[model samples]
Target: MDSMASAPGKAILFGEHAVVYDKPAIALAINKRATITIKESHKDYTSIKSDNIGLEAIISPETGLKLKKGEIGILNYILKALEFYHDSKPIKIKLEIEIPIGAGLGSSAAVTVATIAALDKYHKRKTTLPSIAKRAHKVELEVQGAASPLDTSISTHGGLIYLNEEKKIDQIKGDLKDSLVIGYTQSEDTAKMVKLVKERMERHPTIINHIMDAIAHTTKKAKKALETNDKECLGELMNINQGLLDAIGVNTRSLSDMIYTSREAGALGSKITGAGGGGSIIAYSPNRTRKIIETLKRKGYNAMKADPSKKGVIIEH
Candidate 1:
């Protein structure tokens, strides 16, 4: 018997770095997903395959096998998920993801959630979304050393999520599907970028604190904008939020150019979506998503039109 599961990626609409400081953030799941399929195998060794990342390796749960450079970090999630089930039966697992890696799209969280959900089904555990989310968060913390519950929660629950520093979740009502666009730049080191922000905050607490407060304020206003269906106001707030992100030194030249170019092309608003250094930008393009995508492509950037995901992780028979 084989078991399969999939989870959606996410985009942080407001409050990235500020969220780390115990502020609130708003994130929504995208249509793009990461899928994992697992099947009992005749072989004695557990193996993994991924055509997307060009990885194929046999793993030993007993003695611990060595993984390739890029595979070690991601494979850790799979190894951790496997620990939930006590079976030593060898299994073959395959992963396929639609979102770009390291593009601030929550690829890691999606993959981890899918892996855990699939394995849980295979083991007949029938775990709930909240449980899966908590487990996935632990996996992320194990791999990244430090992590926010936002990514794992969004991937597990799907839809729009309002998360506070206290790890509380509120489901927001709104689907800005037709109004979203994502632009990708070169991959950035998320851990390194996060460290840079911490160092800067330590050096100048007052200045950074004010900027973080402004971002927190924007997130609060953004919730109101969504509730009132005020696209214009929401777009303006996104721009302001981006400015605050820029003040904190997360913006890179490529990311800045993409944001400005999207705005110049009549985007209602544009901002970096993640730990920014050069990852991706999210834009509110109510009627100009096509134009913005085309403009970004002409500038030699990868771009995509996105919609919100309404469902969380799904198990397939």
Candidate 2:
């Protein structure tokens, strides 16, 4: 018998860095997802392979080589747990992440969650969203030294979420009035951007504080707009966040131009999604989403319009 689990990738719609400092953040699980599969076998050792990212590994219970690594290091936490179960029965596992990597989307976290969940089911383990969150939060540290809980939380929970400073997750159910156009800038370097931000934080403490303060204020309005179903206010808040990112020196010329172009084409508002410095931009405007995509396409930018994902982790045999 084989067990499988899948999870949707995510993006920080708002409040990326502030969440780390105890501020509210919002995230959504997009349509793209990854899957993890496990099968029971009689081999002397269990093997893990991921054809997507060139990862492969083997684990043996007899030799005490149980640490999860190589092709699927995201399952390290699950492997540690497996040591306690002592399955003894050798197994084979295969992991695959179909989500576009380094798109400022939470591809890695989604795959990590899927892997843990798959293993949990294979062991008949009870895996709650909170448990999955805790596990994936730690796994994210391996991929991104320090990632806000927003990604894992949303990916695991499978909905639009409001994460408060208290680590309390509140799922906000509302008609996301506008669609978003995702413009792929094709440049991704989270590590470099993190280092840049840290250096800036250490050198310009005051600037960082001011930006975070503005972000907090804008985020409040953004959430309020959502609660009130006010699209205009939400768009304005997105614009505010973009400006704040500019102040932090993470926004690139290409991203800014795309945002400007999208805005000009018809987007109500736009901003760089993740760590900035070249990733993807989200522009909210249901009416103009198509126009924005067409405009960007004509300009040679690979932009596509997408909506929040309705489901997470669809498994196929």
> Best candidate, lDDT-wise?
1
Q: Estimate each model's TM-score.
A: 0.95, 0.85
Q: Looking at model 1, which ten-residue stretch has the lowest summed lDDT?
A: 64-73
Residues 1-317 of candidate 1 have per-residue lDDT tens digits of 78999999999999998888889999999999999999898877888888887767777756556554245646667777776543767899998889888898898899999999998888898799999999998887777767788899999999999997687999998759688999997667677787899999999999999999999999999999988889999999999999999899999899999999999998989999988999999999897899999999999999999899988898897
Candidates in order have lDDT scores of 0.88, 0.76
Pick by TM-score: which candidate is best? 1
Writing each residue's lDDT as its tens digit, candidate 2 over 201-298 gives 88999989878877877876787787887888788889989888888788888899899998898777898888888888888886778889999889
Model 2 worst lDDT run, 10 consecutive residues: 77-86
Candidate 2: C-alpha RMSD to true structure equals 3.7
Clashing pairs in 1: none
lDDT of 2 at 171: 79
Candidate 1 TM-score, true structure as reference:
0.95
